[model samples]
Target: MAKGKKKKSQPKGKTITLKMAQNSMELTVDGKRRLNLSFQEIAAVPKCLQKLCEVDELDMSRNLIRKIPDFIDQFVGIRVLDLHSNYLEELPVTIGRLQNLLVLNLCNNRLTSLPNELGLLTKLQTLHLGLNQLDTLPASIGLLKELRHIGLSDNRFTRVPGCISRLNNLQKVNLDRNPMLTEDTASQESVMISESLYVVTESFLCEHCRKKLKNKKLEISNINKVQFIAAIVANMFLGVKW
Candidate 1:
C-alpha cells in the first residue's frame, strides 16, 4: 500500500517568528522586502520593529494606533509607509527623519494639524491626507520639489494655500467635499484650470462653465497640434537645405 506523503514541516527562524508573532499582524514577503507589520489591531508600535532597518515598506493600515513613536525614525531605509485608517491625531516630529520615504499615506485619520518638519522629506512623491480635520498647511510644503500628487479632499479648507502652485511638478490635487470653498473658486472653469493640472471639487459645473472648460481644452489641443506640425515642417526644411 502506498504511504501517505509526509506533511511539509513549517518554516522556522526569524521568518517564522515574524509570521507568527501576533494574530492581528499579517506578515508577507514581496520579493526581497520584509513585511514588518500590517492590518493589526495594535494600538502602539512594537519595539521589535526598530530592528527592521532593512525594511523598505511598512503597512500598518486599518489598525487602532493612536500615536506614532519616535522610534519610527529608526526605519532609515523605509521608502513607502502606509498608516491609513488609524486613530492618529498628531504626528511625531521625527517623521521628517524618513528622508528616503517616497510615498506616505495618512488618509482617514483624525489629524487636525501638520508639523512643519514634514517638509524635510525632500524625496517624497505622493502624500495622502484626505478625510482629516486640517485647516491649514505649513508653508514649508513648498520645499517638496519632487511631489507629484497630493490628496486633501474632505478637509476644512476655505482656500488652498498659494504655496501649492509653487510645486512645479504637481500633476493632480483633490479638493472635493470641502464645504468652505466658494462657488466661484471651486467652479470647474475657474482660473485653476490648466492643460497639465487637474483639480477635483465637489460642486456641480454650470452650463456656462462646462462650455468654457470644453473650449479651453479644445484650444489647448489645437495649440499642441500646431506645435507638432511646426516641428515636422522645420525638420523637412532642414533636410532640404542640407
Candidate 2:
C-alpha cells in the first residue's frame, strides 16, 4: 500500500479555479482538470496535487472515499473536515496530525473503528460519526479535553463506549439510533464514573426513578416528602436512617 500511496505533501504546478474563505475552503476536482479525478474518487489529496491552500473548513461530502488520505496531515490549519455521505471503510492513523481540527463529520460511511491517534487532537470540540459501521471507539478518545459534542447515531455499536463519559466538557450526547443501547446497565454507569467519581454528583441522574430522566425529572414534587417519610420510619424502628 505504501508504494501506491500518492505523494500528498508536495505542491502541484497546475493552475485551477479557486474559491476561498478564512475558515473554510472549497476545491473542484473533476476529470476535466489535469489532476484527472473521477466522480467516484475514493481520495482527494492527490487530486489537488499538494497545493498550499489553507482553510479552516473543508467539504468533500458525497464522494466515494474508502479511506482518509495519509496526505491530509499537511492541513494543520483546518478546524472542520466534512466527509459525510461517502464510502469510507477506515480512517488514516495520520488523522491525529490535524491538531487544530474541531469538527469532523464522517456520517453515512462504512467505518469499523477509529485510529488510536485520533485522541491526540486535544483541540477537537465536535465529532459527528453517525451512520457508519463502527463497532467500538478508541479508548484514547477520552483524552480530548476540549470535546463538547458527539454524535453516535445510526451505527452497529452494541453498547455505548464507556470512555466517552470522561469528557467533562461534554454537555450533550446522542445515542438515539443504536439498538443495543438499553436503559439498564451496571458496567455502563461504572465506566462513566470510574474516570471521574466526583463528577457523578454534578451529573444529572434521577433518584428512585427506574427510567432515565430529562430536565423535567427534577420537577418531581414529592422528592422531599418521599425522603422524609423513609427517614422518619427508619429512625422510629431501630434507629436506622436512610
Candidate 3:
C-alpha cells in the first residue's frame, strides 16, 4: 500500500475588493468610501494585483499614489488605465511592458517628462498628456503608428514638434496654449497627405502664386510685385528716361 500523499497548504493573505465603475473596476481601501489611499497604511502591495493584471481595465484616479507600484509592470494584458488626478511626477520605464495597452490617461499630473520607451506602445490609440509641466516630448513618440489622437494642451510646449506629422494614422492633434506656435505656423504645418506626405509651412506658401509650394520643387515662371517693380524702374532709368 502506498503512503498517503501530502497535501499543500493554501497561502494566507488579505483580500482586496474592487468595485465596478464605468466599464472598469475601482480598488478601494475599505468601507470608508475613499478613492485616495494616502492616509491608509500601504506597507506592501496586495498579491491579488498579480491576478487582476489580467483585467482589461482599471480606474484608480484621484489616488494619492506618489509612486506607481513596482509590480504594475506585470499587468501585461491591461488595456486602459485611468491615472488622472494623481501626484505622479514620472512614469516607470517599465510601463512599456504593457504590450496590450491602448489608452492611457495621464492628465492632471505633475509629470515633467516622458520616457522614450513610450514609443514601444505601438497599439496605443489615444494618449493624454494635458495639464502637465512637460517641456519636451521624445522624438521616439513619432513611432506610434496606431495613434489616432494626441493631447498636448495646457503644457509648456513652445513649439509643436515637427515629428508629430509622421504618425500616418493620426487624425487629430491638439496643440492649444502653446503660445509660440503662431496661427500662421500651425496652419502651414497641418498635415495634408496626398501621393506623398506633405509638410506645408508658411515658407512653402508662395505669395506670387497664392498656392502652396514645396522646397526643392521650384516654379520658374512666376515673378513677385517687388521684382516686377524693380525691373520697370531699371528699364525706365537706363533704357529710356521716363
Candidate 4:
C-alpha cells in the first residue's frame, strides 16, 4: 500500500433517470397527484418533493433510503405513502402531520420500533409493517380508532401486542412467521376480515373527502355531511387545505 494514496470515496446516493421520472411521476396526470419513485435505488428522499404540497400518493418503495426526512409533514393532502422494501431503521417524527393519510405501507424495512407520533394518523385504515424486526408496538397505537387492517408478520414478537385488542374496528391482522408464537396463538390473533376491506381500494376511495367506509352499513351521504363540517373546521384552524 502506498503511504500517500487515499482510497476513493463511495457515492452517497443513486439518481433516477430523467426518462424514468417522466414516465412514472404523476406530474403529467391531471386527475391525480402521485409520485412513483419506487425501485429508483436512491439512498434518500429527493428534496424536490417538498415543493409538491398537494401530493395524494408518494411511493418510495424498493429504494436504499435509510431515514425519513422531517419535511414529509408538509404534504398535508397525502393519503397514501408507500415506503416498502427500503432500508429504513426509524421514521421521522413529522409523519404524524399527515392527517388525511389512509394507507401507510412500511413493509420489508429494518424498523425495530415505531415512533409514538404514529398514533396521530387517526384517519389511517391500512397499515403494513410486515417483514420488519419489531417485537413490540407503542401503546399509542391504540389511538388509531379508524384502523381496520394491520400487517405485523415476520417480526420478532413473542406475544401479540396488547394494543391490537383495543382496535374495535380492526377486521384484518397478520402475525405469521414470528418464532415465539404457537399455532394456537396465531389462530387467536389473526382476524377474518370481510371481502369489503379488499374491495375498497385506495384508488377507488373518495379523493378530497378521504373518509373510509368500513362496510356496507355506512352511507356515503352521511359520511360526507359529517366529514365535510369537520373538515371545514380543521382546515380553518389547522391551515390544512384538505
By TM-score, the best candidate is: 4
Q: Please provide, for model 3 over 1-242, each residue's C-alpha lDDT reduced to its tens digit, 9 standing for 90 to 100.
A: 99998998543322344432212344444422222222223323344556556666665666555567768788777787768776778888888888788999898889998988899888999998878888699988999999888887777766667768788887766666654444667464433212222233344356854453432234433446568788889998888654
Compared with the true structure, all predictions reach lDDT values of: 0.77, 0.68, 0.67, 0.81
Tens-digit per-residue lDDT, 1-242, candidate 4: 66987789744778765555556668534576788888778897777667655778888899889999999999999889999998999999899999999999999999999999999999999999989999899998999999999998888876678997788788777776765544677465643322221222344457553544444336866788899898899888988776
lDDT of 2 by residue, 101-144 (tens): 98898888888888999999999999998888786889999999
Report how far residue 188 has shifted in candidate 3, in Å: 20
Ranking by lDDT: 4, 1, 2, 3
lDDT of 1 by residue, 1-242 (tens): 99999999632212223434433333455554645455656777666666555677788788778889999998888888999998899999999999999999999999999999999999999999998998789998999999988998877766777778778777778776664544777464333221222353313467888888889999999999999888889989788432
Candidate 2, clashing residue pairs? 23-56, 23-57
lDDT of 1 at 35: 53
RMSD of each: 17.6, 10.8, 15.3, 16.7
Q: TM-score-based ranking, best first?
A: 4, 1, 2, 3
What pairs collide in candidate 1? Answer: none
Candidate 1 C-alpha RMSD relative to the actual structure: 17.6
Please report the TM-score between candidate 2 and the true structure: 0.61
Q: Which ten residues in a row are the worst by lDDT in model 4?
A: 192-201
TM-score attained by model 4: 0.69
